[model samples]
Target: MGILEKIGDIEREIARTQKNKATEHHLGLLKAKLAKFRAELLEPKSAGGAKGEGFDVMKSGDARVVMIGFPSVGKSTLLNKVTKTQSEAGAYEFTTLTCIPGKIDYNGAEIQLLDLPGIIEGAAQGKGRGRQVIAVARTADLILMMLDATKSRKQRTLLEAELEAVGLRINTRKPNIYFKIKKGGGISYNKTCNLTHLNERLVAQILQSYKIFNAEILIREDCTVDQFIDVVLGNRKYVKCLYCYNKVDEISLEEVDRLAHEPNTVVVSCEQNLNLDYLIEQIWYHLNLLRVYTKKRGEFPDFSDGLIMRNGATVEHVCHSIHRSLVENFKYALVWGTSTKHDPQRVGLAHTVDTEDVVQIVSK
Candidate 1:
């Protein structure tokens, strides 16, 4: 159960309470907030393995990849192409009624991926269930604006415009800029590249880098959402991934090349199984995450059951994320990672860790 489930429970309770005409502060606020909460809850959850892109157990940079595009544009097909997911794919629109998650192995690191419901025009007006998916885009590390290359240029523009309305900018330009630079070469005959999303803070004076503007999740470390979004999307040093182009089975190699010229864009065919491996490789490198293994007595530990924390996430937060009492009783955490040479089972809370470290928290 997520925040929505809990909000739903409260709304249902308030509705039941209101049936008898008990309109108090709690009930009144519930009434006012019910609609918003419902919208947030219905935002197509990507509850999948390792973790869903842009979704972590907490409100942090745990997972980082989300796919948003028009319906039937092969978003779910790409979801199945990479990551640990078994989502449904079809020839018709809106086949994926929910957001699905998948896990992909990137150079020994675990990268989370999300496949969301399709977006249609006027989604902000709740047109064709677009509003729901727009909400989910708030919780992503990166957004993949999947487009139909086979569609006419007018149709593609229409899709891009719809995304723009939702505060997400898709990279669809040809004249090269600083989004993704060519590996080798200077000013003379510099190969043009197509970037997947609008990654740069500003593409030029007229263009803002295209991306989903989910204002809620972009909170500063102190809880200021606006500042947080600025840092995540605007920070050039942050590890950003690629924009995935799917459904290439019906398109031409030349078209794919044209798209690849955009910054961080990859061409793939989920239907015909083309270039999927290369796409994964690019995504892994862009994410910049690494995995280290931990074993005791030559046995693997359960990551799900195991409390996984980021390198800087406080021990208190981990305790709370696992169970509140640990944080309430709040002793220290006994970490078991590369820092400890003793038996893996015999480490203490003060031990710092390297990546893929296994830890055990000791509390009263």
Candidate 2:
């Protein structure tokens, strides 16, 4: 089911539990969680759920979206441009001190866009705060690695190989228990990072430089680079990266052209504001979300309490999202969107609504 439905279901369950005096106490806490989540969903982009572990809100699917890149690239710049988020977009290295997020309208859907601290050389080996880098990478749905167009192939290649060796993964079941970085130097075969530069550039070279260490944290222990490729390309749900080759203005035309066709990427120059519009459009297209509106009427739903939803969403998702009991005894939703009477066009529990559509659901 979609997040809207899930939220309704949560709300429904919360209501049902509230009826039982004994469970009311526990229900209250749950309600708070869902309410906060609901608010996060309704709030503008960049404002997200409560930090760390437990039931946080989700967009299309569960995976959190993350943006990655070498220090000094335009990761934050892109975040600001796309989400309208004011991420500290500076020209120096390591400007992003922490993970920041911004929300934007993507064809009417909502997705979490996270900006992580830039990865530095030796990140996997505890350089430039490697642990934190992996921590953020672990929580990402899609990873957008920003490669500086001005940097030579060798410069990019070395960092790529190191990241591969570190093994990017996160174990949700454990509280940062399974995270680890692999060690590498010589052309030897190690469990962490294997090196056999025999095959060279096209395939083997990439394998040597792009493979993950032991990604058994969330994925199968046997997962391969092809699987990682799938995850980045949006097969796992979130769009791989709407790739951007930043600093294009500084690089030669040939380099910019090379980056444009390099695997999955788009060209942009933050300095010159080159092709930024196209880049934003690319992000919007990949996300496929539409803009929806929320309104307050008379004494509208206690949205400040954080248990409301957009017009098209059903009572069930909201209820379950609020608390599980509401779902168990969810009578029926009485809603009014676009008008006070009620919308015959308004679908039932599993209906999808659009932006600016006003709705109210009356439920037991």
Question: What do the candidate models score in CA lDDT, each in turn?
Answer: 0.54, 0.52
What is candidate 1's TM-score against the reference?
0.47
lDDT of 1 by residue, 1-364 (tens): 7655666587578657753333443443443344344434444366665733332223223456777778888888788767567889899999887777777755444566777788776665466767657656655656666777677556456655554434453332112222232333321212134333222232221111222232221111221112222333332122233566776677777887888788777877778898888877776555444343323334566554343344554445555556677656645445556555754544333444555666556555
lDDT of 1 at 20: 31
State the local distance difference test value for candidate 1.
0.54
- Report the Cα lDDT for residue 354, model 2: 45
Compared with the true structure, what per-residue lDDT tens digits does model 2 show for residues 162-224? Answer: 444343422111111122224643222223333221111222223233343322222223333
Q: All predictions: root-mean-square deviation over Cα?
A: 18.2, 20.3
TM-score for each candidate, following the candidate numbering: 0.47, 0.45
